[model samples]
Target: MKKLLLIVTNIDMYASGKLRTGLWLSELTHIYHSVKEKGWNITIASPKGGAVPIDPESLKPLVLDKISKEYYENPVFMDELNHSKSLEEVKNDSFDCIYLAGGHGTMYDFPDDTNLQYIISKQYESNKMVAAICHVVGGLLNAKLSNGEYLIKGKSMTGFNWFEETIARRKKEVPFNLEAAIKERGADYSKSFIPMTSYVVADKNFITGQNPFSSKEMAKIVIRELEKV
Candidate 1:
């Protein structure tokens, strides 16, 4: 079985700490369920070990989908979030793929987590898959390879865009614009013409999803890429 490291944020608040934010429930569940269906062994990890907070906004009636809702209601599944391993714990571990799940809280910690950067660097340099979606793509912004090159540099990818940030009313709360940050790092970033639509970009072993709605498709793409290996 191919092992997958599903990294999520531990920060439960925005940088200002005035607003609540954490992992976007659907982003993790959508990807988790899809990959689990393929029988991949998965581990949920974060910058700090322990419970990962769920974004309250993601649990809204209109936003929560059946799959995510199913996991949310399952005590067994929810327990995984309550006790995720810290990235440091898994720094020496190897995985076939490392997926970064997103939320507003990622804006605060993902880019600065050195252990995360090290994992991505080692994974990418070793020719393993490195994937991320939405705001968590921030994790890729600073990850550099052994050659000291940005992982997303010269790669075609997608992530939560500025327009979507505004649409979600998080333009002011987010620490940085995900799309702009990726471009600043030399990634060829693009998004769906209509916001919140499923848009995924696969550049070699690196796959990225544009938003939460893209998680299912992105997960499928990740599986497809894995099959090739």
Candidate 2:
């Protein structure tokens, strides 16, 4: 069976005026379920190495529905989420792909995480695909290819755009701004025709989704790339 590393964050903070951690639930579910359906052996890991704190708002009935909620109740899934491997514990060479999940909290740690950067570099050097969504793409700024160039150089990608941030901000929620930082990286970026629409960018092996709405599509693109390989 193919192995896929699903990297999520265990950050739970209303820190410095910020409201939450981990990308919205709609971000992780489609990818999780899609990859599992293909018989892929998936390992869910987080920064803190235990009990990843999910955004409570995401678990609402209108969001996750019955089957997803039931799946969450399983001890196995709960265990995986609760005891996800640390970046130090992971064997980068053992996995076919690494997917970084996003949320505002990713901004807190994903970009500067040395361990995650090392893992991404190893995976990229081993000729494996590496993908990230939304703010998690910030992590790529720290990862370098074997040649020492940025992993994002010359790639067409997308992330949570500035316009969407405005809407989320206008709601008097979503503590930090995600888009401005992503655009700061200076890579070629694009978005869906509609702001905050589910948008996934597939530039060869690098896949990126714009925001929570785009997570499932991003997963599909990454899984498809793996299938081809």
Candidate 3:
């Protein structure tokens, strides 16, 4: 069976030191179910590994959907989250794709993680699919190809937009402007005209989503790419 490596943030609080944050549960469950339905195997991992944190805001009823609710109630899935593998535990080339799930916490850990960057760069270099959604795209900002060029350079991609931060009232809490950071790295960033709408961009093996709303769509795109291989 094809395997997918799903990366989630280990950080549980925003840089502001007051606002709580962690992995957006929906972003992981939505894509995870979509891929699993296609008979694909998935391995969840995090920067630090044990007891993944779920953002409190993500558990609110306003944001909870059927898929996420199901995951929330499933003990087996919750157990998987509690025992996620650490980056060091993952074997190179063991996965067919690498997907980074987004949340406010990703901004704290993803970009500067040398091991994470190395894994992503290696996957891309091997012609495997590399995808991320929302703030998780932060991980790609510093990833370097074997040629030493930034992985996102000259690639068209999309992630959490600056405007969304403003709308979500989290502009001050987030560490940096994710959209601007990727643009500065030479990504041809694009997004929905309206904030919080589902928008996904596929550039070869690189698939990116604008926000949590785009998670399932992003997974579909990834599945399509996997089918072609």
Instruction: Estimate the TM-score of every prediction.
Output: 0.98, 0.88, 0.98
Task: Please state every model's RMSD to the true fold in angstroms.
Answer: 0.9, 2.4, 0.9
In angstroms, the error of model 2 at 139 is 1.7
Q: Write the per-residue lDDT of candidate 2 for residues 33-89, one digit (tens) a residue.
A: 888899888888877677777766567776675545766777777766778888778
Q: What ranges in model 1 sit over 4 Å off?
A: none
User: In candidate 3, residue 83 scores what lDDT?
Assistant: 96
Winner of 2 and 3 under lDDT: 3
* Residue 213 error, candidate 3, Å: 0.6
Q: lDDT per model, in order? A: 0.91, 0.74, 0.91
- How well does model 1 score by local distance difference test? 0.91
With candidate 3 superimposed using the best TM-score fit, by how many Å does residue 80's alpha carbon deviate from the native? 0.5
lDDT of 2: 0.74
